[model samples]
Target: MTRYIAYIMCPALLCLYLTGCDFEDEYNVSPRRNFESLWKIIDENYCFFEYKNVNWDNIYSRYSPEIEEQMSDYDLFRIMSDMLDELQDGHVNLLSSNVGISSYDGWLNGYPSNFNTEVLRNTYWSRSQNYNDIVKHNRIVDNQIGYIYYGSFKESILEKDLDNIFSTFSYCKGIIIDVRDNGGGSITNSDRLASRFLNEKTLCGYIRHKTGKGHDDFSDPYPIYLTPSHGYLWLKPVIVITNRKCYSATNNFVSKMKVLPSVTILGGRTGGGSGFPFTSELPNGWSIRFSTSPILDVDKQHTEFGIEPDIEVDLTDEDIKENKDTLIEEAVRILLN
Candidate 1:
């Protein structure tokens, strides 16, 4: 009877010890814990820290003092949002009920307004039939240069649509692909459009992703190639117009297309967002997203800041008042000459 009681008590004591250990292992969902978790997530997974030359440890030391156990949720969110703003990347974002942050101000704020949609529409798109399509192809410059305006990469352009659009512009002198104010969308869409401009398999750029939690722990870069479209490939000269708003996939398009022999990039510098973002949650259930992959230009340099045009041109006030787009005029002149 004594042995049986001892065995039963031993099992009970072991169970209690395991339960206590588990309790200690699980983090309490407090404001401090939430802030710590968010900080660590970016520290481990963010890809641009070294490229951006940011000291992660110093950032932590600076912001950690602001976090307290008794801090309100809104206050914690603000702290985290401000902490992420140090990255200076438009791809980084944090959102909660009380706060929403996207780091676009660093690159776009106070820049020259290079684009006027009212002017573009009144000048060119007004002449296009079915102008509301995802891809609009209009014959401009007195039906000599084919003009294609892509508003966003988010909208998918079908092969059939490309076939028809290209067929419509088959007799033009050259083509102009305008992607101004395009915040980027589907990589596939950009690739789809690029394929139409290539005649052979062309090496455009490279991409890499985080393979480990360390900031610099990324996989070997992979080459991105663009193959000529099987259906309708444009062999004529093409000009791609861009501005500060051309980001993400549009940035990728400019990076790749600039390398082509018959392509010329015009307008202001491109709004660079080469990072492919991924998301995670904090202890408070707020979602935060950041870039974990880096897209490099053909020279294997980061284009996160923006890509310079081959011929840098900005819309001038004098030209705008005369109902003329300086960028458009430049592209047409380049094509015509």
Candidate 2:
């Protein structure tokens, strides 16, 4: 294995071997083969190189020297994990047997959380103890406003669930859908929920995928639309409360919801993972996942990084001591007026 890798590294044989052989089939489980395979998989398949302005070649140059044939599996995984972190994308991850999985944390690390579920629960539970398990809707305040805290898009949301939840809030003038701390789940769930807010077919975003190995090689952007739900529709004013934890499908939901005339997004910027992620494997049997298809807003801009809120409000220390949610307070004020 060492001899084969050393030969491949030789200037003259490098081009010959890479051009003539299919590296995917050359699963030698050697450090060099696994390293090369992991790097190449991301180079050709992963999206967001151009969008994130990452220099893949430069990254390789910096990290390739650290990969030695004598290195243990743990060391190799650490090096590979560090390489994937350069993308700064939450969807990008490296799963290994020795160290479990590596996750990108910069997306939520530096940003203010802007949400406290305990505070929200305590503040609202005092007023209204009733809540539906299917939709997670709680009627807070004087039963004038409907409050639903949706923590995950992964959870099944049926049309019947929406129907039941809205029925409970029939007398309310407005609704607050809290997506704070939602790390996203299924896009189908996102579409299903967003459909309830639309009156007609709406072009909410665009999606594009790689067509070739080039960094800029992508198919023409295709429009993604949301049609009105056949179920109960909410025509009244709606407020979506978001925070840094709102990601992936949740981000997609917020993007579509913000386009509606009756909806207002309030809170911190969403932790965006707009790319539809696809999985690949390294030669050593480790798994890697990354964003392959980039999603854009109606304006054709990449929301892969994040989508800013209409009104940016943070969770203040004072509010925590008082057991108050500032973002929720702001949303209530907006709905009341």
Candidate 3:
């Protein structure tokens, strides 16, 4: 048995000898592979690269050395981040460190979790949340209340100009706003989106970072506000539909809405990814997204843990299949009552 094992080892070592590369060379291959993996994902997934001045060749030369030297996985992620900044598309990006708990463990163990797991999970949650690409305009329900569903925080949705939408909802029994699939987009969009909901302008929430917390006015910038706006639905009871998938700018939307006198969050705990991720593309074609802006609540509590719902409602698999929405039913019932 020992002789047979030695014979097998001898051939394997002989092959390595012929290759003229040792363990160090083999180990280095991993970093390059990682770099390639990221680079390729972007090349395939990004909507457009020409607009971002994507010079694939130059990107590789610029970051290969830095990426190669990254001994720690976290540092390697940083290198990937630095590389992805070259391409400026917000939607085309990477995931977070904490959210990647499963992936990190799987990678280290060599068994590795599937790459699309998070995306798939989030996408499934989003679908379950019943998110639509475009927010339905505000309309009266039974001539008593108004309703609108803004599935995402992307400003593009509001680019159509929301002045009309807000104007329409000015008078109603109450307003029901749904943001279950909002994964978050521009904070500027948050400002404008939130602005449409305000009747009296005042401090909303504070913006914080790894440094600490802050409370800048709406005009201050992303998450830079303490003064609250009466919210367009000030006179109208504002009912926000939330779920575990509510995250980032969406969570910020919820956190701010919580402060409004008229707003009541109904549903589940929000999806916990907060903070604005600064993004860039790598030479290998992978785009990286990292949190650059930290968001805090009125109490200066960061939204990373996600905002809890006031009315805590959930959806069962049956709810999903039967196309039945208990949350919406509850909202309509509350408005009617």
Candidate 4:
């Protein structure tokens, strides 16, 4: 059996690798064959089948009959995309040059958008004296509290960037790290930013890969840890502001920070995408990306759905009208008191 270590972060373009199984003979351009290939690819690797309580065999029974040799690519794509949506995962996507991309975004669609970029930038972040593409940092609330707005994890954060940010906040009582509407990018950035808040090595989460074709066949969970950065550290009160849009790498960051004593996760629950996504190609030249490995919180619990905040907050219409972010105000209030 071949084994590979899966990284627990979300990158812009995830590296794709062929599955260990040989499909040379099955690569013919038949609709049924391609349908089976796609189903089998997901059946063998998708991490959430058992966790989500999906009946894959039942799903096959229902959809397999729909495949026809003469079916249009649009029809086939619709069926396959619908079948994938049954998993209700945001990380799952099917891409075809002929039909475009199909994805399940219901994970974030129905929830309240607790974050507003206009309000954040115009009301609060506009006051920042220091700003960069990766982060916006400044002292606010009578210069007693430090504020940092990190919009995306895709951007890299150098040690000097964090060093400067922390040094600027050295005199403040506490810090607010707002990551609302951050759709996630790289886990490397998440860890680099998180390391500064830790005083020691800590167990942040666990991850396991599918070891066999069985939905339940998974390796023992491996512990994930966060070690303190050698650079400046923040041992004082720290508030992490999150929302439904804080997904993928952002979700992982919140999971890690929630376990720390000095950090409090405020705002709404994180938009979770805890699976380490991997890609597989179908015989028809189409490709699918899905959650391949399951990542659990420090307690060995699934955060695939989301991680709850210590204090749940939503942006109010009144607050929006006044150009105030309720979550930020709440964080400032918590940090100040």
Candidate 5:
């Protein structure tokens, strides 16, 4: 039998694989069947089992007995959600209109939320003379440093927008890009933003997808490159502010930026969701989204947990009381001296 492979492009430039088997036809709409279906979907395609040290067979042994023909939908959802939580990934979620969305936030639960939007707006951006929907840009610290607040990657970033922002800061000594609390949205947008800082085509990361049903089944990692933008470029020193909320595409952005000679990451560690997520439907018509492809950093290392900052700084109570963003202050000081 000849096996054919096809690709579906998802956010973060992830490739989803469609192989020769019809795994969906093997199950029915019973409670036990749905349970098996969910388990099998993750078993066959979820990418982090070996990396995370999870014995999926043992997981099957533990959760299989919980399924019953007469169990309530809520009970089944609870069990399945709990099972996914064992993966401890923020990108994994189970969605149903009946039970709403079941998510696992263990990835961000205990990490310090080093970002405070109120402090940022009131203390920093409030002084900005110009702002737009996607980015807020201005000069700070006696008008010697440029500061840009990019809250989310969901908003579209255009070349003209970047040109305008960079032009405004042409004379500044350096720039600060604050991506704290950015939950992530589009990898295309993140890459577009990162391109402005690059001087050449650079290998930013790698990605691979499952080629078989085995836990270790995956293709050779493919190179992911980021080329310099043709429009505006900033070769000056740059400091990126990050926090626990920087995940998915945001995490990818940080990983790419960290490799550049002119970029320095500051603040807390990022919230990592390095897997490219894919969706599969259960027998009951509910959908489950999970990590199917693993993405690696420039050194071929897994950043599934997160990427540490070059300079780690957290918000102090005293700084909070004074309405000062410690990370921003540190970044400004670095840029100055």
Candidate 6:
């Protein structure tokens, strides 16, 4: 009888030790709470909504049941991503990817370094094999020419690297800023980077657009840039190389520079990707960004379609083999003449 009582008491004590409030609380990371937190954020910060309201009731109705059903976290996030994608704006985009989110811990840190490239190539290479923009860099040929390829405006590191790279072109008789694969970046950076070509301090122009402050009556704010340097400005003929891939802040840069008497844009119509992207996160830990501002040309024309080049040229397979960029080669020919 004594041994039996001891065994029973011991088991009871073990159960009491194991079932504490802290452990139960840690195990109860309520998915519903996470969803509500994100929903409130969207309601308050989103530039616009379906009925001028965030429509949270509908969102909760659509997603809450699934979350309660105990679906995996990834599945829940993808559902939120699809709903946000309906916004159809760049700033409204889902985070770059799952791995990117896990690696950076959040969106405030720089986008991963895998977006664009930096090394100037002595020759041309076919990029049809891969579509990533971050790994592709500015390539140069003939050791005398220069190429600056951009993927987008999201990476701050790339922007810092650009100022240093452009300064090196002070001696080049001509420059080919290959924005062929550039999607866009911070509009301010575009102006800051492009200012290197101007001979003196000048307004990069007010990058502006309307906010639906009230229906058709919109409110606009100007995003402007001014050159910071007095000297070391490359006054040489600047031949901006572009293609369908050149877009957004890049397109904005192209549109503004086209007005300068010293700059010449070369290529086909740029990629139609101009629009200022603003960002927010979705439920289930997915991120989204949408374009709240518009990208306008120097003439204030919107490039929602894209910017057209002054001299259009296409690259052929042979040109890549010879390490000769048809676009840059053409720009040099034109500038030399």
RMSD of each: 4.1, 8.4, 18.4, 9.7, 8.8, 11.9
| Candidate 4 structure quality by residue, lDDT tens digits, 273-312 | 9999998898888999999898899999999889999998
Measured by TM-score, how close is model 4 to the native structure?
A: 0.90
How do the residues 1-337 of candidate 5 rate in per-residue lDDT, one tens digit apiece?
1222223334223422444444757546688988988999999989999999999889889988988999988999999999989999988999987987988777787788988778877889887754556478889998889998887899866789888889988999999999998888999999998999988999999999999989999999999999999998999999999999999999999999999999999998999999999998998888999998888999999989999999999998889889999999999999999
lDDT of 3 by residue, 103-141 (tens): 111111222111222332332233332224446544544
lDDT of each: 0.87, 0.87, 0.58, 0.89, 0.89, 0.57
Candidate 2 Cα outliers beyond 4 Å, as residue runs: 1-27, 125-135
**Best of the two (4, 6) by TM-score:** 4
lDDT of 1 by residue, 1-337 (tens): 9999999999999999888786542535598888888889999999999999999899999999999888877788778877898998888888775666545467787567689877877887888765456467789978999998898999987788788899988999899998988889989989999999878999998999999988879999899888988788898999999999998889998999998999999998998989999998886677888989999988988899889999999999898888788998999999999
The alpha-carbon lDDT assigned to residue 60 of candidate 6 equals 65
* Stretches of candidate 5 exceeding 4 Å from the true structure: 1-28, 129-134
Q: Residues 108-202, candidate 6: write the lDDT tens digits.
A: 12221211222225443332111244433333444355555545655443444555565655455666666666667676667665766776555
Better of 2 and 5 by TM-score: 5
Runs of candidate 6 exceeding 4 Å displacement: 1-88, 96-171, 200-205, 208-217, 221-225, 282-285
Error of 4 at 154 (Å): 1.3
Off-target runs (Cα >4 Å) in candidate 3 are 1-133, 138-141, 155-161, 210-223, 226-234, 280-285, 316-323
> Candidate 4, 276: how far from true, in Å?
0.8
RMSD of 6: 11.9
Better of 3 and 4 by TM-score: 4
Model 1 has an lDDT value of 0.87
Task: Compute the lDDT of residue 334 as modeled in candidate 5.
Answer: 97
